[model samples]
Target: MQQSADILKLFEESAIAAGRVILDIYRAGAAVRLKGDTSPVTEADEAAERLILAALARHMPDVPVVAEEEVAAGRIPDVSGGRFILVDPLDGTREFIGGHDDFTVNIALIEAGTPVLGVVHAPALHTLYLGGAGKAEKVKLDDKDAVIARMPIAARLKGASPSALVSRSHNCDATDAYIRKAAILERKTVGSSLKFCMVAEGVADLYPRFSPTMEWDTAAGDAVLRAAGGMVATEDGAPLTYGKRLPGLRAFENPPFLATGRPSERG
Candidate 1:
């Protein structure tokens, strides 16, 4: 129990430190470039990743790290042991590039295909959300930071009018169809895992990713969402699992999944 709590503390600190580093860069605003995948990559992402990676290496050296920037740079970590760190130093790269304060630094610990701990920090917005060890909370991190919200798993909804949180960047036809058919009323276009955080905090309702996403993209968010009474599940209604050992599968490419706050509504 102590070890779990300690690891959770490390995860939280790493996320907040990464968020601070990213916020410094975001405030200054640097030149942005596109990665080979045509996704945005900034100096903030690189620097924050460097900071967080070093911290994780120092604190949890035995656990391998699978970071987005490192994968993009062709340095995939070995996850054969089925336990490792999943990270997106800057999740909303496009929003960061576009000068929107909607980006996030995301990290999660995946063990045997389950996210046991997760942390997400929105540096620009000065907010942080985390979950682990059967606990989930949201902190508003201004100059004087404070825990503004404690998240609880949502109860069954009264109506079928579930709320939906969609990507501000990657909305697609499939996503549109899900929203329409799902009878989503309150639609929020939040970037990065903040979309997931919304459901975790009971601010928004559901999140459906009809488009492609990698395991790392949602692992941390899923952990927090699940910890706070939500879930990320495969289309077949199975819970989303992570850190699978596929010899040739890419590091951060995610499959289509849904983040639903109301598990009871699945019928």
Candidate 2:
């Protein structure tokens, strides 16, 4: 895209479009299956991913797409240039299948191993978060998914009584210890990348994820959080970068990390 605005519009539209398809399938009660990794998958995931891939192909022909379902199907594109789009058409398959509203459609642009733009859309909740070009925003949608309101958002500086956001589907002792060690005064359970959006909106101050996650699962939310003046860092306080392929590890695998609404020196 020539401008950041163009990228933002495309990301937002593409995410929302995929979300619409997901909702349609969700309403009809989709059948569930398992991927090679034993994680759950549904028709909504496949259908939404297909819709997102097509949209990206049409609008961002030059950019490579590393989408979840596509990767599972051995359809990975060449992202050697360090610039590509990461997509999780349905970020919270379990939540969706469980009839919860925490699932989302996620899209992000990674440049030089860092996300510069991102969009997260929750169709069931009619909520969206966009981040890029030094701006981060939360959008409210109507029943038909039309934008009803938009507000600028930014991360709040950490304070003494910081709150934490934890995952509903994947809970671990490591995360709990981190929260306890940090002395987090409050905690909330969330699914999908909505945890990152909540931090971006200043609703929470921290999100510590110790569970295994792929790049697509976190890229979009990471972008939004970063754009909102927040930070995603490894345990050592280093900025979390994408395009990772450590030896003996799966491609796009991520290390345990912490998410916070603090000023990121790396940014």
Candidate 3:
């Protein structure tokens, strides 16, 4: 139990440190570049990844890391042991470039095909959300990285006309279909993993993604949500797993998945 708590602490510190780096670049604006996959990346992403990677290595050198920027550069680590960390130093790059507060720094620990822990930090929003060890919480941080407040959170029960969220950057036909088929009466379009955090904290009830995504994009928020009593599942209603490199599939690519504040809505 103590060991789990310690790793959770490491995730918090590493995420905050990375968020600070990202905020530095975010304030000054950033130069945009396209990765080989045609995704947007900025200096903040690279710099934060460097800082987070070093922190993780320093604390847990034996465990491998699968960070987005590093993977983009073809630096895949061996995570066959099914125990690894996933980092998206700067999620919602498009939103960040567009001067939105929805961008976040995401980190998660994946074990045996499950995300057992996660930390998602939105520096611009000055809010951090984390989950692990059978609980989840939201944190308010000051400019100096001091925790000003913290509170436990949990997923809400699904109600009539439960709210749903879609990605501001990645909404597509399949998502629209899900929203319609699910009879979503209220919906909000937001960016990054905040969708997951919102559901984990009872702010929203559902988030479904039928488009392409990397494991790092969802793992942290998935962990937090799960810890808060939420569930993330693929189209077949199976739990989402990490460290994927299947035949004819790009490594670490995620299947179309749905994230719900309550497990009752799995589909």
Candidate 4:
């Protein structure tokens, strides 16, 4: 971790670059493939990963990157010590394939099993959410950088719904049950990591996904949510703590989790 300013600026640049790659492939309609996990993959993922990885290497050379495409290509980086960046170049392949504008570019800095900074950029939406330095703010960037909404955690506007923003394409049975039991007021379906960003920006209240998810899938959003006074927790109400080293494990995966808008909102 460097200065919060430098890291965040680097993250914003990389995220927007990845966003450009995503939008290009998205509009051009690229080829699609499947990974070993049976998840969708596309050239956009690879291109975005390349762009993000290159930026990270040039700017934060010391920080290793755990990228989704690289991991799927059997090239997971070594993150056994210190700090690293976790990236998901194309987070919602389903939404991307369906010709919807819900996918995003995700990037995060993790130190000692905790994410210290995160950025989520939805190029199609022209929205960027950044959280770090004990603060979180949502920025809407255009040809010129402009701050659309900037507020510390406590100053965000509260929504009218007991809002539950869930994955647009990957809904599980457990999520249905959670939503019903929670008595949600409004439901918004968006793809990719933007679900988490919705909560971070106060557009929604909670996101509960009781389905299996890899660490990279949630690390960036997790950091943003946490920095914005929210948390990703387990069923038992434990805040997600990443990067646990096991004796022989090469890397790690996350269990089913719940993402909430506020600590007190957890029930």
Error of 2 at 261 (Å): 0.8
* TM-score of every model versus the real structure: 0.92, 0.97, 0.97, 0.90
After superposition, candidate 4 runs with Cα above 4 Å error: 143-161, 245-251
Count of clashing residue pairs in every prediction: 5, 0, 0, 0
Question: What TM-score does model 2 achieve against the real structure?
Answer: 0.97
Per-residue CA lDDT of model 3 for 125-212, tens digit only, reads: 9899999987899999998999999999999988888899999989999999989987888999999999999999998999999888
Instruction: Quote the positional error of residue 87 for candidate 4 in Å.
Output: 0.6
lDDT, model 4, position 29: 95
Rank order (by TM-score, best first): 3, 2, 1, 4
Note the Cα lDDT for every prediction shown.
Answer: 0.81, 0.91, 0.92, 0.80
Residue 178 C-alpha lDDT in model 3: 83
lDDT of 1 by residue, 179-229 (tens): 888676778887888888888877676788987677778888888888887
Q: Model 1: which residue pairs collide?
A: 153-228, 153-229, 213-254, 214-253, 214-254
For model 4 the TM-score comes to: 0.90
Clash number for candidate 2 = 0
Model 4 agreement with the true structure over 234-253: per-residue lDDT tens digits: 77777776665435434667
Native RMSD of candidate 1 (Å) = 2.3
Residue 245 C-alpha lDDT in model 4: 46
How much is 17 displaced in model 3, in angstroms? Answer: 1.2
Deviation of model 2 at 199, angstroms:
0.4
- Which ten residues in a row are the worst by lDDT in model 2? 258-267
What lDDT does candidate 4 reach at residue 180? 89
